[model samples]
Target: MNQASRDVIRPIRADEWPKAKELRLLALKDPVAPIAFLQTYEQAAAEPDSFWREQARESARGTRVRQFVAEGLEEIWSGTVAVLIEDAGSDDAFGGAVLQRQAHIVGVFVRPEYRGSGVIDELFEAAVGWAWSVEEVARVRLYVHEDNARAESFYRRYGFMRSGETVPMKGDPSKEEREMVLDNPQLVSDIS
Candidate 1:
């Protein structure tokens, strides 16, 4: 079947914790996992069931975080991306101050067979759409590892531009993760 016919992009429900955990573990095992994520398969895989439950619940509706999944044939998830809202001047998870109210996209992963099949684009559309829907969100942003050219290029194509902010990669001080931003042009035009 074609990509569109086989896939559905939607927000993950609180009860879908098992599916969420499974997809994350699979993503961490992919060949490019090292550059794509901050956690290792061992670490994520070792987490308790309660941890997964909490994680899923936190990303459900009514929270500041949301996880969107692309479920392909047979209801299996083919890709996932998560967004976390950050308030301006508040310290981020990495100890850096957020410069503005924005949604931070993270944990992007797509199954190998689904790569380049527009799965990522669909996931991004859902994620960015949610980000823009927030009342105080001025834009959306994400960080790409300096060496992750494939990911960086994808984000660029999605309208995200380098924001000139860099953060040291966790556990890899020599490398950097550059911040990219996509301003809410609709909001900008409205304000003008």
Candidate 2:
């Protein structure tokens, strides 16, 4: 990849989760953000460094979950994506529902300045690569707020199609979350 391109994508180091957490809080502060993220900045900011460390460790730990960051030469974080593998028969954060083995994508964000610069494509390349690299995963899926058209479009561009599944946001019965899935895990391709 070219310098400009290569400089944008990589895994968040175990030591960098503090910054990772910070940037994530920044992303949550965006205006259209509420519909994009499940957690609020206030909640994330209240977390201690140990919480951040545990999160980072789980992300980098072999397939339990992973976080990838898009950084520029100055090490500015421009984007990020995290994927969590849901084990079969284990209840997810949502409730009693269980999955055999599917990767759940979440915590996706791209800086406004870099939103259309192919930065996300690389970040996703790393994420989907890691997702597919796992053996038991049949697919990778994510939920988007029904009103988040921009994120819906980006997700569609990544080959994620609506699965006709919708769940009420945990605490908000008024809004629904739509599930989108990359049905063909083997088709993950290069960004450029």
Best lDDT among the predictions, by candidate number: 1
lDDT of 1 by residue, 2-103 (tens): 684579999999899999999999999999899889999999999999999998989886469999999977897989999999999999867998888989
TM-score of model 2 relative to the true fold?
0.90
* RMSD of every prediction: 1.2, 4.0
lDDT of 1: 0.91
Q: What local lDDT score does residue 7 receive in model 1, on the 0 to 100 scale?
A: 93
| lDDT digits (tens) for residues 73-152 of candidate 2 | 89888888898888989987667476668889898988888777888888888888888888867788899988899999
Model 2, position 144, has a per-residue lDDT of 92
TM-score of each: 0.96, 0.90
Would you list the C-alpha lDDT of every candidate in the order shown?
A: 0.91, 0.82
